[model samples]
Target: MHRLAIALLLIGGAGTAQAAGIRCDGGLVDRGDLQIEVLDACGEPDFRDDWAAGSLPAGVVAPDVTQWTYNFGRGNLLYILRFRNGRVIGIDNDGYGFDADNTSEDCGPTDIVPGMTKYRLLSACGSPAQRDSRVVLRSSRHFRYGVAEQIRRETWIYNFGSRRLLRKVILENGRVVRIDTDNRGFD
Candidate 1:
């Protein structure tokens, strides 16, 4: 029974990894200054919704939405691509670092306040769906439902020296955070 349980866990993990939509063989392109690689492993969508369009080519499977988020200290950038038959159908980019509520303002230095978690920042300023850590701050967020139902995940630089938050970015889910982290602080 224990062995069976272990086997099931392993299978589950593998399935999840397969569903991340990370295709290593695909090409990488620069969208502005950001270079994005669309992986063949485009896994399953976070969840299926009726509002999501089903307009892909007939018989061609839709690769789950693949998300790549980058945090470049001053800004956070996210790319979500939905592919059907190996061609992109949907693409979205939410610039991080900038105030999510405002389109005019680029992300500034004042966004980071100590004691802020990924969730807290989203509550204060929305639109970030995910997050991770780097020299600056990185995170991402995605909402499959609607603006009201947006799911937010976030990560920011927690400087132990200054004991404050700085350069935060948000991404869309749990998987992106794990891949984007460089040095996670103790606290």
Candidate 2:
């Protein structure tokens, strides 16, 4: 029993290490790869988001951050690649991918929830009928001196026809923060 437990622990650690890299077009793209290299290996991603962090000093420029989401297929898991400056910094698995051809109209407004990625929302609910975005400065006590960061906020309004109410999904940075139901939707 002791030997079996040791083996299982080793296997779990190995699985975590393996998740640091992803395969693309017979090539492996790992952390520290350049953005161009990932693009060449993986081709274009299904969804892309670009934003910049706020700097503390007046003359300092914050690095630009980009997130690329790839959905291989229904049988595979969705991957989100985060790039800082021009190099890959991290890779995260969002959720299970769905068939692109069959997902557009398959979900309702209640399917959306906080913390879900925009890529997942798009896959489940399709494009929003209306979209609006703006950048706001938010101050946080976590940082020394309560520094303010410029954050991007977006509102996506989905119309599910007259049968369902309109859903307004609010996103901060790139993740969904809140979901609200408006009045009845149009036909």
Q: Of the candidates shown, which would achieve the greatest TM-score relative to the real structure?
A: 2
lDDT of 1 at 87: 48
Q: How far in Å is the alpha carbon of 82 misplaced in model 2?
A: 1.5
lDDT of 1 by residue, 1-187 (tens): 0000000111123212112222222323322222223322222222221222234435433233324332121343233333433444443333333333343323333443443333324434443323332221122344233212223243533222234333334433322232122343334
Which portions of model 1 show Cα errors greater than 4 Å? 1-64, 68-80, 84-86, 93-157, 163-170, 173-187
- In model 2, pairs of residues that clash are none
Tens-digit lDDT track of model 2 for 51-135: 7554345664556779887777765666778888789887776655666777756678778989888887877887889998776
lDDT of 1: 0.31
Root-mean-square deviation (CA) per prediction: 18.4, 7.4
- What TM-scores do the predictions have? 0.22, 0.75
